[model samples]
Target: MNNEEYVFAPDDFVLAGNDHDAFIDDTYFKQSYWKDMLSRFTKNKGAVVGLFVIFLIILMAIIGPGLNEYTYDFQTISHQNLAPRIELLEPLGIFDGSETMSTSTGMVEINKYVSEDGSLTGLEDTYYWFGTDVLGRDIFTRTWEGTRISLYIALVAVAVDMLFGMSYGLISGYFGGRVDMVMQRISEIINGIPTLVMVTLLIIVMKPGLGTITLALAIRGWIGMSRIARAQVLKLKEQEFILATKTLGAKDFFIIFKEILPNIFGQLIIMSMFSVPNAIFTEAFLAFVGLGVPQPLASLGSLISDAFKSFTTHPYMIIFPVIVLALIMLSFNLLADGMRDAFDPKMKEM
Candidate 1:
């Protein structure tokens, strides 16, 4: 047959690029999971603002104590229950033998000099910025100190929960059947009980202390995390990579740690992020019910409980700490939401 006649019209063989390797490597950079997650996170404006609010709260918590002259233990008998005073930086007039000394505001001379103690003053003094509590301690200082406590409790509790929960979940999920059934049944039993009631009972029996409170909260908090880890492990256990590792004579531990664990790390991180706020809230609730960190330590919930007595007169005491706590909780929730959306497999499908 002639070449032109035998050419199978225009639908014969299609010409394609032979740079498959280059395309695969190049496309990898564009489709990176972390890059996409970060991009999606940054696009969330509310999360960005929440992050800034959290940063500011943390900065204040760290620096506010140093800026104040009074210590958390400092108490002044004469200054007890005194409102903040405004100190003016005006020139003092010198009085001669028969001359009278007077203070002026701005070209206006005052006839009588009245020294008033414990009155509402403007923000010209260092005594109080936000105001004082019933104890006359600086609200600003106490609020920051409270913040440090709350953050510390939340972080520590989450860390402990993650350590125990992730390990339990990994083991249960990697080895199904008996291990999984026993662990999950136990989790269900724990989940069935009221978390608050268990915490209260522990507090009553063990006497509520920081360590006790943290331990109590961690007991129940880990269940959700374990369930999440278990689900992730179940999905990843049968993957091609995991099967390949098994075929290569890799040990179960090696396969679980090296292959399966890495695949579920993202989900674990997102779960941890969501878990932190819960821990903080749990601690706060304990404190509110008098089973939290003891007095003088100043957790947000403790501060709120204390402020409730003087709320009618000194609302700032409650308002300031509540605002700080709200900001922190909001920040964590926003971060969790962002992570959930970013790491969601269904999102990638869309």
Candidate 2:
């Protein structure tokens, strides 16, 4: 009814220049799988902190032993059981080279700088950041050296086990039927034996050193990885892409490694991360039981074992190594959890 004053003017409409280009430019960019996984991983605060802590520990493990003048095995009976002292932190009353002893008058705090006669011992300038062990060796230096050994053992064991597991699982799953059956039975038999028992037997048979420990771990370590890889292969083998690859006459090896492995590699990597902590803990346990690396070559477990006897008198002896071991285990677990969440598509949805 009021159409008399309304008229469409050409000036009211503006030409939209480069609207297609704008749409194209504003479209979301596609990211690669690893890039997406990394983006998700970085979003986890706990995981990021764990990664940073692990990096710091690794850096310290590499350089910490050399920071102080004293070698790990350097002994001085006069310096035995000296409390942790640092020149920088002493002014704050902590790490002031003090030790508490149970005397006839109950507990008495004594300055490391003072001798039995209560006079200056002339060692005020001396510092042992983690004090000294019963053998008068530097605990700080030994701790780092021990960390290095523990890490080495864990990494090497895990690497060896992963290689075996991945290969076994791929072959077993790829060639199903009798091949799968035989492989599964063999793995089951190996897995039936308790890991501790295997390790013990190996220690009894061979020398209880790094190689023995590594071999013992490898014996049963691959079972879990093999199972995981097998399951993944089973699941993926029936997928359309795999069927297509097979139809295309791809070689079995090519199909397994190139087509299938790349698909399941992320899961395998996650499993490997989970296995690291177990390997580390196992090595530490063996070391604690007097089956670890021999003398002059310390591991975190051996260090803890050495400190256990004097723990009642010098609690510091055990504290440092235990703390380091705990941190390493915790950080790896957190990082593994983060990786699992990041790489898993189902978790991404959650």
Candidate 3:
């Protein structure tokens, strides 16, 4: 058959013209990348649970200590080393246990009474929920307080690291040639030095305090983040969007910060999430080894160290703090994993 004779009818299939307005209208109603990411994150049970746990920890750290009248400064020589008070649940009795007889105004009475020995004489005995530390301070209270320190240090250190690392990485990555080579070499030299040795040297020279410790950690911690960010920028800088921006004569700063940085922000956020746990661990270790925050301000590591001597008798002190620390670390790690999955381009490809 001739080609002309075999032509198909226009009605065989409908044609949808490329209506830019229709496409624009559809896109206007579509969910953004952040919204989709949020939906995906919400569906991740582990991440949701981790976020809940972290929120609870933060809430406890912020509010729990305030519930107590003793502000870690309430002291009594008489109460030192005193065991936690144990109160028993009394069995229900007939007549609602009302044994009130008289009062100063007229004649009022109550079933509960204080003993001459000062023990809770009217109630039955119960176990201490968290027991007590070596100094007889409530382990439960101290644990929450210590949690605040841990989370605070982690957050501050991560912030400092990110600020320095991101700036250095972006500048080096965008500039590439000599600047990149110099910065990368410097990073390598710093990374070559043992982290512990550098930390120890700083502690010795700077006189150990929370600020000094944080600063020391920030120095070593930024290297890995910088390298990761630089690598990301190198790959992203060659993309079409970046090239277009350059072609339009956009300023270097504008292209780097406005275009490139925003695109790689997910990776930066994931890296920061991972960095927090590391900073917390580093602070804890430094404190444990006497190179951490100063005295009177109790960190989990410091509390654990203090409880070491009486660990046999007051194991609760160490146990409680360790549990809190572990929970914080675990939650951070889970959150990091979630972020990694959320940000991973490979997953999107799949």
C-alpha RMSD of each candidate structure in angstroms:
9.0, 4.4, 9.8
Model 3 misplacement above 4 A: 1-30, 73-129, 345-350
Top of the candidates by lDDT: 2
Off by over 4 Å in 1: 1-31, 80-126, 204-207, 345-350
Q: How many steric overlaps are in each model, in order?
A: 0, 0, 7
Top candidate on TM-score is 2
Colliding residue pairs in candidate 3: 88-124, 88-125, 100-109, 100-110, 101-109, 102-108, 103-108
Q: What is the lDDT of residue 80 in candidate 2?
A: 88
Q: Which is the winner by TM-score between candidate 1 and candidate 3?
A: 1
| lDDT against the true structure, each candidate | 0.73, 0.87, 0.73
**Candidate 2 least-lDDT 10 residues:** 19-28
lDDT of 3 by residue, 208-319 (tens): 7777877776777888788878988999988998889999999999998899888888888888888888888887887888777676667888877877776654444577
Worst 10-residue stretch by lDDT in candidate 1?
A: 90-99
Report the lDDT tens digits of candidate 1 across residue range 1-350: 65665537786877776955656665555557778988888888877787788888888888988886876656544344344332331233321101123335333322112224745534223345555666666666777887888888778766865788888888899999998999999989988988778877887788667878777767787888888888889988988988888888999989877888887787788778778787888778878878777766778888898888877544556887888898898898887777767777464353
